[model samples]
Every structure is written in C-alpha cells, then in structure tokens.
Target: MISGRRQKKLGVRTLDIAKRLLDYGFHPPTIYFPLNVEECMMIEPTETESKETLDEFIEAMIQIAKEAEENPEIVQEAPHTTVVKRLDETKAARKPVLRYRKREAQKQ
Candidate 1:
C-alpha cells in the first residue's frame, strides 16, 4: 500500500489524477481519504499482479506527473476518453437532477 499526497504547487488535485487514470485504462486510486492527510491517494497493489502490470502502472504514474507539471489544464480537465466527461461534483451532490422534464408544445 502506497499513499501519495498531492503537491499543491503542481496545481493538480488527486481527483484530477483519478479521473485522468481512466484515459490510461486504469481505475483511479483512493483519494482524499484517511482525513489526517490532505489530498492523499492510496494505491494498493496485490501480489497477484504481474511485474509487467506494475511496470505499466508505474510508467502511467510517471507520465501523469509529467503532465501535471507541464500541462496542468489537461490534467485538471481529465477523463477525456471516458464514456462520460468530468462533471460538477458539488452541483450533482447539492442540486441533483433526478428526473427529466420534457418541454410542452409551444404556441406558434
């Protein structure tokens, strides 16, 4: 288990990295948990995982770090390849749109 803390100077949050992981064909790590640590990302790799898989994840992480430094905006607006794009999490949680409302016919 490896827990990484975000570097605020890098101008990227763990959530951004988590979303970006989808584009790299990986699931996002646990972020901002444990309460004590700020912007913590917890990664737990099982022994069942092969060396190649671990290497790929390492490479992906390195690449993401580089992207975070060079192109923070891209990292900030992530999950470009996912089925659904980034959402307003606060809005979704606060003002959820549960049902769809159809428009009535307008008068000509």
Candidate 2:
C-alpha cells in the first residue's frame, strides 16, 4: 500500500483525480484517509495486476498531473466520458434521487 500526497499547489483535490481517472479508463485510488495525512491517495496494486496494466496507470497519472498544471479545469471537472456527468454531492445528500425514471417513458 503506497500513499501519495497531492500537490496542493495544483489546486486539485483527491476527488478530482479519482473522477478524472474514470475518463482515462481507470479507477482512482482511495483518497483522504488516515486523517493525519492531508490530500492522500492510497493505491494498493495487487499481484494479480500485470506490469502492462501498472504501466498504463502510471502513464494516465502522469497525463493527469500535466493536465492539473496545464488546465486545472479539465482535472477539476473530470470523467467527461462517463455516462453521468459530475454530480453535486452536497445537493444529492440533501435531496436524494431515490426513484429511478425510465428515460423513454419520460420522453413520452
């Protein structure tokens, strides 16, 4: 288990990185745990993972880092490729969308 700290100077939170990873076809590491550490990302690569997979993850991370510096907005508003865009977690918590709606029926 290796935990890496985010660069506060980049003005990007661990959540942002995690979300952005989805766009890169990867899941983001666990973030903001071990309360003692600020802006922490914990990655535990299992033995089942191949070197090629790890290499790809590293490349994606490097790209994200560059994006964080070059265009923070891209990193801030991540997972652009996902079916659902970013959600307002605070608002969702306050007013949860409990029921599922069929899109076709709604269109009718």
Best by lDDT: 2
lDDT of 1 by residue, 4-104 (tens): 45435788888888888899998898887877777778888788989999899999888988898889888899999988999999999999989866667
Q: Model 1, which residues run further than 4 Å from truth?
A: 1-6, 97-108
| Per-residue lDDT over 1-108 for candidate 2, one digit per residue giving the tens place of the 0 to 100 score | 333355357787778888999999987788887667777778888999999999999999899888988898998998899999999989999999898778996888
TM-scores of all predicted structures: 0.81, 0.82
Which portions of model 2 miss their true places by more than 4 Å?
1-6, 100-108
Candidate 2 lDDT trough over 10 residues, lowest sum: 1-10
Deviation in Å, model 2, residue 89 alpha carbon: 1.7
TM-score of candidate 2 against the unseen true structure: 0.82
Tell me the deviation in Å of residue 16 in model 1.
Answer: 0.5
For candidate 1, the 10 contiguous residues with the lowest summed lDDT are: 1-10
